[model samples]
Target: MSAYIAQACTIVHKLIDAGHHISDDDLLLAITAGLPHFYDPFLVSIDTLSDSEYTLELIIP
Candidate 1:
């Protein structure tokens, strides 16, 4: 997780340094939006356990 986050941050930094005009929030949002498609199925399953529970709790509570 840390490595993936670091890689994303590095990519964002590179894009910024190259004058690509991407804001930090925009990069973060794009990354998050694409995460389900990019993540490995096993990892997604593991992450889903917590995320789904939190989402359900938020909706019900």
Candidate 2:
């Protein structure tokens, strides 16, 4: 795996081990914390959307 993917997985695993339920908000906070400052505006845009809207925008298949 790439370094970024490995690091992200490690973070999620640590969170899981902490016994807290992992929600979308927790994942988002983790991502925003790791990304560069240039991504802040994009992250803020995501924060403004409803959960359904955010999922739809992701276009997951």
Candidate 3:
């Protein structure tokens, strides 16, 4: 899980450094897409987050 989170962070950092404008919805989709199928339930739960409440904090620590 730590490796997966680290990889996701790296991808996000790279995307930002490359000057691409990624919206939170798109970012979350990308992250979830890369995760294993076992994480589907948790991802589905987060998909309902309001725009202002959406964040990557859950996987950061």
- All candidates' lDDT scores? 0.57, 0.64, 0.73
Worst 10 residues of 3 by lDDT: 52-61
For 1-61, candidate 2 gives per-residue lDDT tens digits of 2475458757878888998677655655565577788867977877887777765226211
- TM-score for each of the candidates: 0.47, 0.52, 0.60
**Best candidate per lDDT, number?**
3
Task: Report RMSD for candidate 2.
Answer: 4.0
Candidate closer to the true structure by TM-score (higher is better), 2 or 3: 3
For candidate 1, the clash count comes to 0
Supply every candidate's count of residue pairs whose N, Cα or C atoms clash at under 3 angstroms: 0, 0, 0
Off by over 4 Å in 3: 18-26, 58-61
Model 2 vs. true fold: TM: 0.52
Tell me the tens digit of each residue's lDDT in model 1 across 9-59: 788889989988876546545555556655657445545555335332332
RMSD of 1: 8.6
